[model samples]
Target: MRGKKGNKEVLKRILLCIRPYTSLVVLSLGLAVITVGLTLYVPILTGNAVDYIAGKGSVDFGMLGKLIVLIIAAITVTAAAQWLMNHVNNMITYRIVQDLRVQAFHHLHRVPAAYVDSHPAGDLISRIITDVEQFSDGLLMGFTQLFTGVLTIAGTIVFMLTIHPLITLVVVVLSPLSFGIAGFISKNTFQMFKKQSETRGELTSLTDEMLGNLKVVEAFGYQEKAQERFEEINERLAGYSLRATFFSSLTNPATRIMYSIIYAGVTLAGCFTVIAGGLTVGRLTSFLSYTNQYTKPFNEITGVITEFQNSLASAARVFRFLDEEPETEDSPDAEELTEIQGKVELEDVAFSYRPDQRFMEHLNLSAQPGQRIAIVGPTGCGKTTLINLLMRFYDVTDGNIYVDGHEIRDITRKSLRSNFGMVLQETWLKNTTIRENIAYGKPDAADEEIIRAAKEAHAHNFIMKLPQQYDTVLGEDGGSLSQGQKQLLCIARVMLDLPPMLILDEATSSIDTMTEIRIQNAFGKMMNGRTSFIVAHRLSTIREADVILVMKDGKIIEKGTHKELLKQNGFYAELYQSQFAPS
Candidate 1:
């Protein structure tokens, strides 16, 4: 029952995707029907010509010539309609594919960060590119042929039944066996194809990971292990591909064999009918032609079913991704944070990445306006998670985070986030000019303002040394730049933004001590009037913090000024000592 429902859902989504092109689809189908009708009628006309020649005792040249001309005209019409159908079908199929790709790409942005974090980028990309393209190709073939196949079968059957009911009965009986065989193969193949599609995604993910981190893999001398890992996935993908192909391949031959058997039976029955004078020789010829035409469609349909099964499998994956729940949107009545005071407070904050594991419970903290609150914690102690909650990347499970006394949830995410400038440890830059990278937080920033921010962040020196200076376009996430340079660019962005609040997560961890000192001095000047939360690894950076919260296991074990904590010789003291004590 679940399987049926899933299949129906996949089909429903596919239909919905194609719905916008209904007019073209209808026109394509109409052309197919016209083609099939003309083609079917031509064969009947040819049969009549044969009957005319046979009855006249000799070839009636004039009448035969006229019949031949009529047949030619019908064939010409059929060919024209078939050509038009193919053209229309291709247009409709590719257009639907374009729309689906756009929709899938658009949907990804709306999906929750958790979904993206858990799913591989390569897998999502495969669904959007490979699976969607394959589905479109399959759809094209199915749409192009399915209508003609059905119409030809129905028209051929009707014509055959009219010619000889007994032979048609033989055909009708044997036809079910063909359909039954195709159905059984189709059912088995669907799962295999679906598995193959999934395996392909896995393989793509692994390959993408390996290639994207090839330098790291090579540096670590893990190429052999990576190769083995890729081979394992590749071998499994190949196995699934072979199985899917083998099963789907069974349909055409199996159906064709069944069709041949039916053809033989129909021929025998027709021969008997002709001998009995119930059917003429010309009619037998026509019946044989009709039988092949009828069974030919079944053959085509079996092939279509195989393609359709693959397409359905791919479509299911695409739909599954599309159906992923997006991030919770702000409420309609949510207020915009137009002017923020930089004061933040977390009240009884209880949260966890997973509901089953309660990471933080009854957590409370407060930051006064213009206060530099440094958060010091052991790794995975909900430090970044706290930042995430503060930024509303993930909402609190059972708490309220207030910015200037307004609950973070009550404010629009865009408006709330815009109030804070963040420079994370891991920098991200687009493939664009260094000036644009710095101005990302303020897209309309002036050149002088951008240069001032870069100079303050100590990035202007490197920017001046680059090929095009600030106008240089970076490659793939600014991979062309050094890590410290990237960090400087990010810091420059925050400097340009100069939001009411700041979140720095090891923002200068990549830079040299000299550069870090300069950046810290700049930060000191900037933090004078803005609230700041710094997640520091190097204890030396937060000596002047108004409050230092030492976190462990989601609890703030100690909270005081850095000097106060050191004086007390508690968790913060030990952490600071451990970092700066020795090597």
Candidate 2:
């Protein structure tokens, strides 16, 4: 069973989204009332026409014409009212969907980097787009239709009873049975729809994964395997969709059957009353019309109820995302750093991606301002983990990290991160103009400043040679540029930011020897007067470091200048010889 508190809370949140449109809601309800009033006059008009035609009452042509005119006027008014109600409903839905999308996006931005890393991009995209759209279509339209159906049903039933209590009994008797069928079908359909949505999310995740790694899939000849996996998900989704349709489709037919039975019973009973000289033709005609009107709202009500159930299921998923807690940040009183010299120190910092294992423990290091420090280690030796901690991407579990003598946790993350620039091994570039990509780091930078930064990164000459020079558009992920050229553009972006501290994690690892030399030269200039942390697998890149730290198994096994480390002849010496020695 669903918790009562949870249902109430979710409904409260959904209602809050529409609170701003209460005036429109009021107008819609008012229109619905007018529509009901107009439709209720139809049965009375039919009764009057029957009496005049039967000649059992005095005939008045003028009065008959007026009654017919009133019937037509009522229909016209109902149509206009319905149109206005629909427009208001659409406006309210639009406003609510807009607010929901914005709020979901804002929450996503505030979530922790770890949460983002752990969740699939495709799944997140589906929740924001498809799930939210489902909620809008189902919850908004379903509820509006439901409200109108209820009002129509109530008004019709009350007027119906006023005509003849005996006929009203026939209609009311079948209602409970009709509702039971609708409720059962709705419950089954809701389950199937939920399953369908879940399958769709999985299919979306699979497609995104394949597309993101298309090159690898092609190179490894896994296209067939990927397709097979996707087909499995698609097949499951189709099954669930079909099941939902099968169940929901029963609602209208079952209600129609009950409506037919009630109509037949009422017609038979009216004939008996007329033949017994107890009821006139006009009264019987009016009762039949009322019976039809009464059943119509039940049909509509049943359909809306089914739709509401399905929508509620979708809405539950959407609200779950909205309720997610984002990553926490520093308190309002957190310290702010205006300027940083980039003196960094890490003492006994321990961390683990999982609770049962430790990736790093008791790690100790320090770097002076403007000094170039290099970290070298084997694969999975916590080299990148150290950089992550220093950048405060993952807070240390055990010890303190200080930059310029201030505890990292005490400072606002934005203020702390503003002082550092990073260039990763895989350079990422947006599908945009070269000029815009370079200026991305500092959006306010002038064209001349961008070009100057490009020159400083040794990327200006090559950029000028492109088809449109700086204005040339890059393909997705900078596909238009060679690997080395893409790396050059990344360096230029970093140069534009010109942070006080820098982390170069295998920045030159992918470039050719010739490009590597140019990058190294540009890097030396950029490093001047800035504290630098260099993680290099290629030992030659870090020969000029003011200090070198050798790490193994999350511990800093050795630390010293290059000459001092060579004399120690430990892990660093072994790693250097292993790479440079003859094959």
Candidate 3:
């Protein structure tokens, strides 16, 4: 029952995607009907032609010529209709695929960051690309064959009934056996197909992980182990694929056997009717043709059950991704945040990634306009988590964060985030020109403005050295550039637009000491009148900050200037002195 419900849900979403292309589907259906009707009619014309040749020289040449012409005309029309039907099906199928991929990708962004962080990137990519492609193939096959198959079956049954009721009943009586075979097999095969799809996703994920981090894998000399891991999953995937294919393949031959039986029985019955002089030789020939046409649908549909099962599995994966819980919507009364005071405050904040593991609690801080606050903490000390809360990437559970006296959640997230510029230790650059990467935060920035920001971030020297200068294109997140170069570009991006507030989380960690000094000077100018939060591991770099926050175990254990913290001779002093201590 649950499996049936899942299938229904997946089908419902697929139909919903098809809603915009309803016109094309209807047109395709009409063409399919016409194609089948005309195709079925040709058999009758053939039967008539056979009657014309019943006895040598008794043949009616004139009648035979007309029947032959009608047969040729019917065949031509059917072929045209079939072509038109397939064209319409392709249009509908691909259009539906386009819409689904767009929706799933767009929704991916709206989902909480945690969801993406938890899932493997390759699995997600598989759903978007591979799985979606599989779904499209299934849909295309269904449109191309399923409709015509059903129409052929119906048309043959109707035409056959008009000729002889008793013979038709014999054919109809055995159809239930074919359907039962298909239904029973299809029901059991769905689970295998679903497993096969999932295993394929895992294989993709592993391959992606290894290839993406080829450098690391080779460096660690884990190739043999990696290959073993690959083979282990590969073997499991093979088992699933084989099972799915084996079961689905059975449906075709199984139905064919039943069809063969029906065909034989009908032939004998029609031969007997002809012997009794109740049926003409031409009619028997047409009846036999209809028998093939009738069984063809059952064979085709049962055959498609293989693709249909796989498609359903792939479709289920995609729809599940589309249905992921999006990030919570802001309050209805949320308003655009404006004006640039640069003041921020966190009051009684409490949060955690997992409910049982409280990352932070009762955390509080205040930054006055133009004050430079340095956050110093050991690893896993909520330093980045604090930054995340300030930026509203993850909201506080028990407290309110305020920007210029307005609760952060009360303001639009876009407006709130736009007010702050951030540069993190980890750099990100798309496969695009350096100028575009820099101007990402400010796409309309003039060339002169972009170059100026690049100069400030100490990326101008490297940009000028590149073959294309600012127009130099990056590859795979700026892989061609050194870590420091990428970091510089990221810094230049934030420098391009110095918002009212700033976040520098180890922004200088990748650069050399000499360049760090120069870039720090640039950052000082950028942060001069803007409230800034700097989460740093190097204690010396933040000596000039107006206030230094010392964090430990998810709490701010101490807060003061460097000179004051040293005088106290506490955790902050211990950490600060150790960095500069002798080996």
Candidate 4:
């Protein structure tokens, strides 16, 4: 179920990410305490040394020497602790961010195909990459400055109280004003930062769209329009960024002004105490130093509030994605198909993308162990949807699909999908060597096996012409390869696996007539005893199918052998005529 996540929940999740690094967290915290404690004690040592130095030579030289050395030692230790603390903070922040990115990536795999299909890839990439990096920045500040600042403030208060309660009371009363200012500004900027984050995601998505389709944009002379669109998004992001910065920036000066009042009040009250003999001059000096130490952290806190707000916004985006409801998992008792014979059946199947609109209904189909079933239909006629159902990418709304007598829902999705080899119209080749692309479906396949698959797909000859033959590295999505070549690589990938069943959805549309003929011959041998479902817009590709199903409006209206359907002169015959008849 989808749910709105609050800041507390998002923070809680971040803490959970940190749970694995408990030792590091504890060490950083300990270092912060040591650093702040020594930092606060330094003023005391300085004040005592001030008391001992009555005049130049009249000063107690021996006592001053010990205080000077002790002060130096404390300062050195504080510096060292602070450094170690920062190093630890970085470790925790980056490690947590690393875990978060890994988890987000793996979560995408479990999410429904519908989610990936419907969402913009660029937006998701931004959340996983850009947003996560922003969160890391915020997290590092939170771990180091936030923690140390709070500790320093607390330690200063303790020292002030031990020395004189009345002055400490004044400082404590003025402290809430600082918190109030920081809180107000942070709250205002939080929404702006969130808006800024979303705008950035939109901008990234637009840029990715333009880059991925650079050829189309250039061909259509749409550079000016694309730039205009980019400028609009970039402008909106700038506005949001400026507004958030302006508001959060106020926290610093405003808090500093309030702190100035606290310093003034402490100085006036502390002077009166020294005059009345209630406080010593040296103690007064130490108390004043404590006052500055006490207020310094508030300044530091407010200064970082802007960065923290941005971090929180980015974190919220990441958490929202991580919180998405993953696809329904298989039941515990889901059976595995160890030995499949390629028989498939759909009984009274009903499906739809939306509940209010039914697309396919009461659909029934059966394929014997070895048969070629060609599906012919116009666009939006459920041709691909049927294949999706068979692959278990989407479950049927009613009835059940069975493979080898086992209900598909009852069988594990992995095993069911593994038994089917699919090649789609859109070719997707990883940026790797030709051998790896061909062996993608079966990664452990031998080089000889990969060569055989490439040969079957009529891709081996062209691959050999490359610099490294099978070892030739391809560029993004098969690089500068022609559409036909790319499609052949995709075909080779599936051929390498050679699963028990096959689904080819316009898989050969990009290949030339000569290559298509050879591939068809290869498929003829491959489909000898395997159940095959071929979805083709070109009527001639499936002329020899044992059965042809003509679909309209998501329902099968005609089914027969190609010759039998031609004899019926029904919808299937009409489609065949449209392709074969003279213009």
Which portions of model 1 show Cα errors greater than 4 Å?
Answer: 52-58, 271-282
Clashing pairs for model 4 are none
Which sequence of candidate numbers ranks them by TM-score, best first?
Answer: 3, 4, 2, 1
**1-583: candidate 1 lDDT, tens digit per residue:** 1276898988888889889989998898789888988888887788888888888477788988998999999988888888888999999989999999999999998897778889998899999999998899789889888888999999998998888787798899878888888988889888888888898999899888988888899999999998898899889888888988998888878888988898899888888888888987788888899988999989888889898888988998998888889899899999999877888999999987797999987778899999999998889888898898999888889978999999988899989988888999998999888888888878999999999999999999889998899999999878778999999999999898798999999998999999999999999987888999999988899899999988899878889998789899888888878878878
Task: List the lowest-lDDT window of 10 residues for candidate 3.
Answer: 1-10
Instruction: Judge candidate 2 at residue 213 and give its lDDT.
Output: 89
Candidate 4 lDDT over 310-361, as tens digits, reads 8888988998899898988999999988778988999999998898999999
lDDT of 2 by residue, 419-461 (tens): 8899989889999999999998788899999999999888999
Clashes per model (N, Cα, C within 3 A): 0, 0, 0, 0
Query: After superposition, which runs of candidate 2 have C-alpha atoms over 4 Å from their true positions?
Result: 1-9, 57-59, 274-286
Best by the TM-score measure:
3
Model 4: lDDT of residue 208: 89
What TM value does model 4 have?
0.95
Candidate with maximal lDDT? 3
Name the better of 1 and 4 by TM-score: 4
Instruction: Report lDDT per candidate.
Output: 0.88, 0.84, 0.91, 0.90
Q: How would you order the candidates by lDDT, starting with the best?
A: 3, 4, 1, 2
